[model samples]
Target: MYATFPDLLRLLFVPALAWAAYHDLRVRRVPNELWYPFAALGLALLAWEYVLVERTSLFLVRAAVSLLVIPLAYLFWFVGGFGGADFKAFCVVALLYPTYPSYYLADLALPLVRTQLGVFSVTVVTNAMLASLGYPLALGLRNALAGVVSKLMFVGRPVAVRQLAAAHGSLLETPEGFSRGGLDLDALRMYLRWRGVTLGRLLAQPERYRDPATVPAETNDPGDGSVTTEPIPDPASEPAPREDADEYDDPWGAARFLDDIDSTAYGTTPRKLREGLDVITSQERVWITPGVPFIVPLFVGLLLALTAGDLLFALMRLIGLV
Candidate 1:
């Protein structure tokens, strides 16, 4: 048996985990190209151990345990529990480390630490899941210190109608206490599709957005509550009408974009700036979902699994509960 080769195995497993973590952190996805090769290599290595090294029993048992876990991972992804990349990463882990490698966690003295786990990848995932559970506490502490605890705690908070047009990760409220889907980026993207604007464009060049006065008006249907597809002339493009005053300043000004945010899903009305001016001007905040990317905690779990074995098992031993 190649006892020294475990160090080489660490080199194999850790690098792929690190690389996937990097891309997942950056773009919220890890490409299939990364995991696919690693998965194939893992299977090949397992095959070599079984056929060439003559460790048939160990190889079969390890592979069997890992294979059983795959369906559960797929089910999680199917139910929207996690992303595709996370599920694939688990599969790759199963292939790479079906059992605990001889080189890893050699110094740990915990009685519960197994030399070889039923499925080593399951331990890694369990550790990762436990690590992710701590994230909310971390976020709560961060928001508390930042003095946004009240805003963060509430599911929704009142914000100015003006801020609604530019808000991210937050929702807007109609005066009658219904929510507009401000945080729902998908719906907003659909709404912006007709304007030839993508989310990237909105983020990059918000100033280039069409003037609110120029947006084509839609006729409201009282029956089905659908807006009719009626094209209207852009008022800004029309010739100036004769007036007694030399200049008339629009009180609403740039905030006219707020009117377009009304959604049929919630049956929300376009809230006026004046209605919530008191709360908006004073609090100057809105409700936010405060979502964290799953990859960060997954990376942390990988590190802990390498050095600390199973986190819940370790904790049980520490408190003498086992």
Candidate 2:
């Protein structure tokens, strides 16, 4: 009649993951502090579960699952497929629900399906990956409706250069042709703010700054040298350029800016800035793919794993392969 401890812990994941998904969507970053309490609780649950089972076969299964899931999480992060936050999340999931938890609502059993592996965290991740497959299909449909036909349409959309500063994605098209490593827009916005000039102004007078050699450097930087959380201003609101503005022969010192800001944080380098600037100055519209954060699908996957069970496993079973 009453919910078990594990079931109660499973329910707690709803709010925790929901908040994490919301945070990741709002800003690509998730605070490390958010995982601490959940991780601690998971460890406590793990210890309790361990003591309860001791040297039983169930304990061995849990231990084996833990060993597998933790390294898999680390591997995902090491290979850059998963973010640090995602890695930590998976670790917590492994500790909290190494095996699928059983729950029921009256006569109905929660998670209508179960897999032979019974690794709950793996189910959540696999489900997340399956859910993410929908994004490309949606992008392809939208692009097709707009009369844009290209293989690239499945992964990216065209955005105007004027909107680039305010955009969320990386550029797929560049002066060097198509590049898998898209230009980082956050770094571009940071560069703009550092110069006290809007993207419109820069684009309109590209000759004045395109070379980077002639762009003027500030005598004293205005900001506290931290990346600002403020929204990038719309290019439409950009002030008109002064007619009497003097051209500088000195270099823009973009590398200096990158160095000062610890460029690794933004995933940008001087070469990338130069290439991105070339594309921006030369093109009116560029293709970009606004990457969907994995956490969004991970949240969906967690919900599905708790309800309908492993989507991949279900599909395999349906196809008579599992």
Highest TM-score model number: 2
lDDT of 2 by residue, 91-204 (tens): 777777777778878887868788887777788878988999998999999999999998799999988999876576677866779886867776677777666666887898
Report the Cα RMSD per candidate: 10.3, 4.6
Residue ranges of candidate 1 with Cα displaced over 4 Å: 1-7, 54-58, 104-112, 115-117, 151-195, 198-285
TM-score of 2: 0.84
C-alpha lDDT values of all predictions: 0.52, 0.73
Poorest lDDT segment (10 consecutive residues) of candidate 1: 219-228
Q: What is the Cα-based TM-score of model 1?
A: 0.60
Off by over 4 Å in 2: 53-57, 211-252
Model 2 clashing residue pairs (backbone): 213-251
Question: What tens-digit string does per-residue lDDT give for candidate 1 at 136-155?
Answer: 67766666676765534434
**Consecutive 10-residue window with the lowest summed lDDT within model 2:** 218-227
